[model samples]
Target: MSRRPPDGEAPVVTAIVVAFDSAHALPDCLDALRGEGIATIVVDNASTDDSAALSERRGARVIRNGRNEGYGRANNTGVRAADTEFVLIVNPDVIVQKGAVAALVDAAQRYPDAGFFAPQIVEPSGRVFFQPRSLLAKHLTNPGGKLVLPEGEACAPFFSGACFLMRRSFFLDLGGFDEKIFLFYEDDDLCRRIADTGAALIYVPQARVGHGRGRSSGPKPGLVFKSRWHQAWSRAYVSRKYGLPDPAPSMFAVNALKTLAAGLSFRRSLIERYGGSAAGALAFLRGRSALRQEGLS
Candidate 1:
C-alpha cells in the first residue's frame, strides 16, 4: 500500500483501492468518484498488467507490490498509509453509486459509537451479500430473528469489507486485518474484533455499492474447493476466538457434521465435473486438509 501525509489544514477523506490485475473495471469506478471530495490511493498487488499505470493516470496515487501479497496484507498497507480522519476501503471490482461514499461518512457521524460501518452491498445481479457473523451470533439463541438481512436498519455485528468507511485511528488500533487470512473471512474477522471492542459495526442503508460477484474466485471446481475450505477455516478460527464461553465444543460438533456432509456432496460434484474420481477425491481431501492445517478442528 501507499503512504501519504494527512492534510492537516483541511478535511480530506482518503479512499484506498486494493487492486490485483484490476484494469477492466477500474474506469467506471473512477468515473463514479468524480467530484467526490476525497483523495484516492491504489495499491496494485503485483499486477503484471497495466493496472498500476492506469490507476496512476486516473489521478490515484499508486503503490506497486513486488508480488501478490494477500488481500488482508495489501489493505493493511493502505490503512497504514492513510492520513485522513477516515479511510474508505473499496475493492477494484465494485462500483459505488451516487451518494454512497458520502452516506458512509455521514453514517460515522450518525452512529458516533460505531467503529466500522458498511453500505448496502448489492451484487451485479442485485442480490445482497450476507456475510454471516460467528456461530455464536448466528445460533446461541435463535434463527434469523435478531439477524437483519438485505439492509440493516440498526447496528450490525459484522460489515462487509468490499465497500466500507472506517475511522483511521480506530482501525489502526484494532490491528487492521489478520494477514493470516489469504482471502476469504478477513472482513468477518475484522468486524468480530471491532465488535468485541464494544465499538458497534453498523450498516448504512443509504450507502450502496455494486459488486461483480466472485471476482477473486473464478468459476471452477478448484476455486470452489479452495474458497469453501478457506471460509470454513476462518469460521472455525472466529468461533474459537469468540465462542469459548458458550458450549463451543457442542456447537462446533454440530457445524462439523454439517460441513462434513456438505464436503461429501461437493466432492461428488467435483467427481462428476472432472471425470476423474480419484483426482477429484484427492482435491477434495486437500481442501479438507487445508481446513485442518489451519487448525480449524
Candidate 2:
C-alpha cells in the first residue's frame, strides 16, 4: 500500500544521501540528519570503503548497489525505495542546518504551487559565490541570485542541486534525472524540467545547508580528468537539448592553442585536463549521447 502523510502532523520526509566511498564524510552528514524528524536513506553506490557500514552505524537505512552507479541513477534508486511524499536530496558532504528541513516544509505549505524548493547553499568556509565565472560555472555556484525581482522567496529561475526538497509525485512524473549524464548538468536539467512544467521552483533563503566543497570528488587525479570530460560533454548536451547555441570552449582554449603553437609550453596539468575536455567536445560534436568511459562518483 502507498503511504500518505498524516493530517495535522509533521509531513514525513525521506532524506536521501548518495554515497560513494564516502565513509570519511558520512558520519557528520548522517549525524546532522539525526533528530531532524525525517527518515534517512543512504544510497551506497557500490563504495569500496565502509560507507554502507557507517550509514548503518548512524541508524540510516542502507540500499547498497552491487555496481558503481552514477549520481542520478543512485538517487533514483533511493527515491523509488522511499515511501514519503517529500524527498530531500543532498550530497554526503552537506550538513543540514537547524530548521533547514522544517523551513523547507513550512515553505512548501505556504507555497502550494511550488513543486520544488531550494534552500541557501553556503560553503563550509562561510562564503557564497554570488558572481560565478561562466555559464557552466554558474552550475557550481548560486543559481537564482540574479533572478530577484522585488527581493523575496519566489519561484527561482533555477536552483542549486546540492540540497533541496522536492515533491515525490511530481519528481516521479518527470521520469527523474537523465541517467545518460554521468555527473554534470543533471541538476540544471531537473530545474529546467520543473520550470517547463509551469510549476514553481522556489528559492527559500530561510533554509540553509553547509557544504564541505570538494569532498564529493574523491580527490583522485583520474576523477579530475573524468570530471572535466563530463563537464564539457554535459554542457554541450544541455545547450543542445534546450535549443541554445553550441557551447564553445572558454577563453582558456585560446591559451591552450597558443601553448601548443609555442612547442607545448603550457603547464602539463592544464594540458592533461584540457585533453579530456577536448575529447568530450569532439564526442558531443559527433552526436554521442552517453559517456563511453567510466567515472568515479
Task: Say which candidate scores most in lDDT.
Answer: 2
Tens-place lDDT digits, model 1, residues 1-297: 112335656554688888876787777666566446457788888886778898888888888888767678788898888788888898887787877877888778887788987888889777777654544453223354454474355666666778888899998988888876656668877876787778887778788788886573224445454455455455545555665442323434554555556567776554333332222234333444332433433
Backbone clashes for every candidate come to: 0, 0
Candidate with top TM-score is: 2
The TM-score values for the models, in the order shown, are 0.73, 0.84
Off by over 4 Å in 2: 1-11, 129-151, 248-266, 295-297
Q: Which stretches of model 1 miss by more than 4 angstroms?
A: 1-9, 131-133, 136-152, 216-229, 243-297
What's the lDDT for residue 192 in model 1? Answer: 69
